[model samples]
Target: MILFENVSKTYPGSHEALSNVSFHLHRGDMAFLTGHSGAGKSTLLKLIALIERTTRGQILIGGQNLAGVTKRKIPYFRRNIGIIFQDHRLLLDRTVFDNVALPLIIAGLDYREITRKVRAALDKVNLLNKEKQLPATLSTGEQQRVGIARAVVNKPPVLLADEPTGNLDPELSEEIMKMFEQFNQVGVTVLIASHDLELIKRMQHRTLVLGKGKLIAQFPEEDS
Candidate 1:
């Protein structure tokens, strides 16, 4: 569902974050993006979400060229993809229900629909019982699950997560990864950017490794 062709991203003073990167993520594919710090993993995700545009080449999602998308249409286009961050990014003042309802609220859905979708998403992350609690009251793993619920509340076809298990213990990390696996089983295209090599290897999914802005290797070469 995602295609990148000869993509590059450069910032001020010729600082190139990515150089000639290319990959294709077929529908229902789940892959891990592995790289060291400053290896451009986050930059690549931003390009897909349109938070940052590519400096060269093209990006296609579901057959639509992102280069042709206008600035005014970015919000609408982004609704097709769900993004999870390492920090969870929940609003401390809001209840779990409200946090997950944010996307639907912004989309102008009515209260009834938002309520239904929010509960369903929280259920997916096993947070339904915590819906009335504030984000600060939940444990780190629960907080991350809240973030996951919020991201998928809209039922976006593609999910992108960056260092999703960065703060959890191995058991919790495995739990979180299993949640992602469940999502993928139902056909949500999942791409996660994480540096947890051992965990990534354990999962045994396709992985793309980067070094100094280049795609240095793809694991289980048979997939290539």
Candidate 2:
């Protein structure tokens, strides 16, 4: 669950990236964040992930105030959230299995458990056979799936994606969205920031829109 109370984020030059944006995403809810470029979508996700701190107001995740989270506890806190990027962000040199296994490794799982989770994640993305391959050897869409696999390999409770389907074709984009749906059905809270209005409409989930630095609209499924 996520709750933002009058949250605002301003940069060093006093450029406010978010202005009094507030919203509540209940546990297991799936929503899309949409707006024009520079509309603070990424900033909002970063605030939740603690990549950046809020300039004002407060953020609560599963009842834990992020303001109280110390820098030393960031890594431990992140274990509850999974993030996926549009660029795939895979390691060029490592095998796919290794990349997906990184999070579990950091969490100190043993080799057998890591192997099992890595294989299961790859299977979820239909990339189990490609586990031994390097990132460069995969196609664009395949690479993105790899990123998704890596993000969910740890089975985090909340998932955040920034323009996840930006680089893929329409069919691939739909496939990626369905993957997120599958995760959500299993009770993973999903928040995706994307610009594809048509795709968002097709998904028919809750949508939150932003303009400039403010939350302009939030539509429930029936209203969307």
**Model 1, span 22-118: residue lDDT tens:** 8899999999999999999999999999999999989999999999889999999998999999999999999999999999999999999999999
Could you tell me the TM-score of candidate 1? 0.97
Q: Write the per-residue lDDT of candidate 2 for residues 63-85, one digit (tens) a residue.
A: 99999999999999998899999
lDDT of 2 at 165: 97
For candidate 2, the per-residue lDDT at 40 reads 96
The alpha-carbon deviation from the true structure for residue 186 of candidate 1, after best TM-score superposition, in angstroms, is 0.7
Where does candidate 2 stray beyond 4 Å?
221-224
